[model samples]
Target: MLYHTSPNYLSSQITDNDQLLFQKKKTNDLKEKKDAAKQKLAKVTFACREEMLKLREQKAQVQLEKLTKRKDKIERLIKLEHEIRELNAKTFMRIKPMHNPTTTTLYQNIVNIFYYMMVAIVILGFTYGMTKIAISTFDSLQNNQLTIIAAETNLFKLKEGVSDIFETKKVTTSYSFES
Candidate 1:
């Protein structure tokens, strides 16, 4: 199995082997460059997509805040409108104030009548109190007059008795017992 080849055959075999190795090395280098380009493009695409998503999220947040404020404002306006309607309904519910003729005159007449009635009652009460006081004063004066007349009659009787005793020649006798 140790058969020797000729020199020509050996040189041809070496040249063919070197050509194949060179071709293989070229293909490997091309494949490595293509892989590097693909990796770089993938990284760039990923970064772009991430930035787009972040911007979209920020825009959505701003829109949500605007929507929330708008909703609150609408609710507040509706509440104010409801309160205004209730106030108007409550204040204007009465029909008499809206259709009465000379309402001012009627109101004033009523107030005046009440005022006069109260005045008359107060005057009557004062007159009654004054009449009671006058009657009591007259009774006290009559009682004083009667007392004065009785005292005068008593004094006259005492004077008469003294005159009678004087006319009878009354003498005073005195006796003393000494111990």
Candidate 2:
């Protein structure tokens, strides 16, 4: 349908429409600026978060390295402590000399005495064994000499018996018969 309208009304409506378009353009521009601000804020927040994560990772790595070093030191300390304990538990004769003169003298004397006692015991045992061997040898020699004497006496007696038997046979025999 077509309707007749006044020029004043048309002109007023067109001006109003132009004002509305300007307002819309201004609002769109404001919205674009806000969007850009939001995007910038998000980027900044992401960057900050990434930096924090990196810092945290670095801190963790440093902490781990520190703990590892501490653990290594503790292990070395434990080994050294064990070695010290071992050294402390060892006898003086097994290692370096004692520091104190009196103690060193005492240790020396004790060691010397023990050594001499062991040597004396060994020598005495060896001498006793040798003496026992000599005595046994002499006893064996005496026994052999007695056995030889006994054997010689038995041989002489056997000869005498044989001679007596021959003499008896000779006396008992008569003259032989001629054939």
Candidate 3:
């Protein structure tokens, strides 16, 4: 009875050991699957980070190109403004007068000479006309005075003839009485 019982106890112990070994193998398989998943997640995160950096670099390049174009445009506008100012200055110079002082003075002198000559001629003509008028007036006054004297002498002679006629009439009458 003791020997038989010992064999039974040994068989039970071996079965229990086999069950523990199978459980340990299952746990190891689960742990390996979890580690593989973690590795895959890390690789994906690294790829995403690299893509974001590339996008940022492209944006910076585009901004630099825009700024360069704006600078070029401003420089062109400044050049154009400078050219316009120069043209305006040249035009103003051309528009200004270019008079010759000598020629202008000569023309003025000629005009003054003509004006003086005209004034002298007018004064001479006025003087000559006044002299002629004075001479004609003097001759007319002398003729009037001579005509008045001749008329007075004729009146005196008529008065004397009348007086002699009256005296003769009176003497004839007295002689008639004496006779």
Best model number under TM-score: 2
lDDT of 2 at 175: 71
| Candidate 2 error regions (>4 Å) | 1-4, 92-179
Candidate whose lDDT is highest: 2
- Can you write out model 1's per-residue Cα lDDT over 91-153, one digit (the tens) per residue? 444213323443345455556567778989999999999999999999988998898899889
Error of 3 at 29 (Å): 3.0
- Report lDDT (Cα) of residue 95, candidate 1: 19
Candidate 3, number of clashes: 0
State the lDDT of candidate 3 residue by residue for 1-179, as single tens digits: 67657966778767767777777777777777777777777788888888889888889889888988998999999999999988965654333223323323434555655777898899999998999888888888777777767777777776777777778887776654453
lDDT (Cα, tens digit) per residue for candidate 2, span 70-173 = 99999999999998877765655444344434434446757767877998999999999999999999999999999999999999999999999989999998
Q: After superposition, how far is residue 133 of candidate 2 from its true place, in Å?
A: 48
Q: Name every residue pair that clashes in candidate 3.
A: none
RMSD to the true structure for each prediction, in A, is 13.2, 9.5, 20.1
